[model samples]
Target: MTPKIVIFDWDGTLIDSVDHIADSLHLAATELGFPALERDAYKDIIGLGIIEALQTLYPGLAMDEIQAIREGYGRYFFSKQTTPQNVFAGISELLAELAGANAQLAVATGKSRRGLARALESSGLGAHFAVTRCADETRSKPDPAMLMEIVEHFGIEPGEAVMIGDTIYDMDMAQRIGMPAIGVEWGVHPRARLEEFAPAAVASDMAALRQALYLA
Candidate 1:
């Protein structure tokens, strides 16, 4: 863990929220008269914000219609759903180990701040992250806003920080910002899809992830 500063993506990397996200998204899409997204569609459109994901799902939709869909989705996501979340297996142990090693941890996610905060508090993982960059706090992934903001917050060089996530968007963000990326196979995206982004390394699980970081 020589880098010390590690930023993680939340949804598929640390917590398993795919089923919930898919269900919610399906509901929203149906209400908007759009086709339901399959698992592969979900995997493809993830890492972007809800609006962006909806745009990807329905490319020909008008701006006003898209806004309406976004509003409907947000209402459903906040009021009717509980995020359908569960921490991944071995994540708690891994976080504990990272903390014990005196490494600096943070979160840079596309989730809204309130949503991310509630999820973290509910999962008992809030204390593990020193800083969190949410959708409201920065531009979305591929922009490097979250990564650069977190690096500045930690007073560390971007090269000394590692971005851990399951999507190519995370790898692209890290690369754009001059940080190494650790792609995880356990996430929503396929390993081959992630490799398309040319990540610094790929980890099959938390234990292997630790070893990769150790070598770095």
Candidate 2:
């Protein structure tokens, strides 16, 4: 059965911004004279909040260092053009179809509130979601705090909602709260990585994703 509430992850799942994000992180580290890891290493942290991602990538950072990297990353990321064109093909249609079906859509992302605001505006997808939860406003992914908040806001049971994302963190958070999860492949993490979390389904394309949501 289709869920009444559908929660989505932002960066990799809705938009094709993984390369842009990974590149910006590399640029930030290079600008700070910090050692750069493989591009995949940057991509691996896509679902995590900026501070948490930075801490995982470069451990033992002083508060000042974390702030500096955060600022630098923000500078690099915002410098690029973020437009509706970044949204994945078929996403707008999918959101429309879900909304038409009376599904309550929401975003549970690792993006800062400010960042998500800009993305929503640029992507022209903001009004499609009934609500949004940002990492800066609550505990980050894999903690279940943000997801729980969204579920609570909608006054729905965990089983009545479904999470669709591109990372293990998304699956882990939903699992912790007993919410069903669906993984998308064309994102930061591979199918194998998402499979380890035992998602309800792993979609390779938008059509498959729609089918997984019982829309097709």
Candidate 3:
């Protein structure tokens, strides 16, 4: 059966913002005199919330220092560019097609509320999602709370909704909630890692993702 509601992850899934995220983290670590995260380790944390990211990387930092790091990362990310950057090709078309097909699109992201809002506004994607839940607002990805909230808000059962994202966090969360998920190549985690979560499809590209979601 076709899904009535579709949940999407931001950052590497829909936009090519992994560089920005890694860069910002490096900047924050340098500014705070903490060790910078390695590229692979950094990529692994892409779908996690900022606080959680910091905690995992620097597990013993003081609370104030963690907050400072968070602030510093935000400064680096937004200051370097005039606006959000690096949306993947065909993303707008995919969302538009999904919308045209009467899909109720929602966003379940690891981005904080402020970060999600900034990206949505800068990317001009706010109108596409009928509802959004961020990690800051609920449990982070892999926990299923965010997905359940979106489904509950829309009054749809888990079976009627599907998640389209590019990370294990997204896939695991959907699985825990008994929702089907479609994985895409345009994300931080490797395709093999994403496949370990058993998504409905590990789409090789945006066009394939569109076909899987709209045609399959």
Ranking by TM-score: 2, 3, 1
Q: Candidate 2's residue-wise lDDT over 98-213, tens digit each?
A: 99899999999999999999999988999999899999999888889998898899887898899999999999999998999999999988999999988999999999999999
lDDT of 2: 0.93
Q: Which parts of model 1 have CA positions greater than 4 angstroms off?
A: 78-85
| TM-score-best of 1 and 2 | 2
- For model 3, residues 113-193, the per-residue Cα lDDT tens digits are 988888888887788999999999998878899999999999989989999888889999888878999998877877898
List CA RMSD, all candidates.
2.3, 0.7, 1.6
Question: What's the TM-score of each model vs. the native?
Answer: 0.90, 0.98, 0.94
Clashing pairs in 2: none
- Candidate 1: pairs in clash: none
lDDT tens digits, residue span 26-57, model 1: 77778877776676786666677766677778
Q: After superposing candidate 3 on the true structure, give the runs of residues whose Cα lies further than 4 Å from its correct spot.
A: 80-85
Cα lDDT for residue 149, candidate 1 = 90
The top-ranked prediction according to lDDT is 2
Candidate no. 3 TM-score: 0.94
Clashes of each: 0, 0, 0
Query: Model 1, clash count?
Result: 0
Ranked by TM-score, the better of candidates 2 and 3 is 2
Worst 10 residues of 1 by lDDT: 76-85
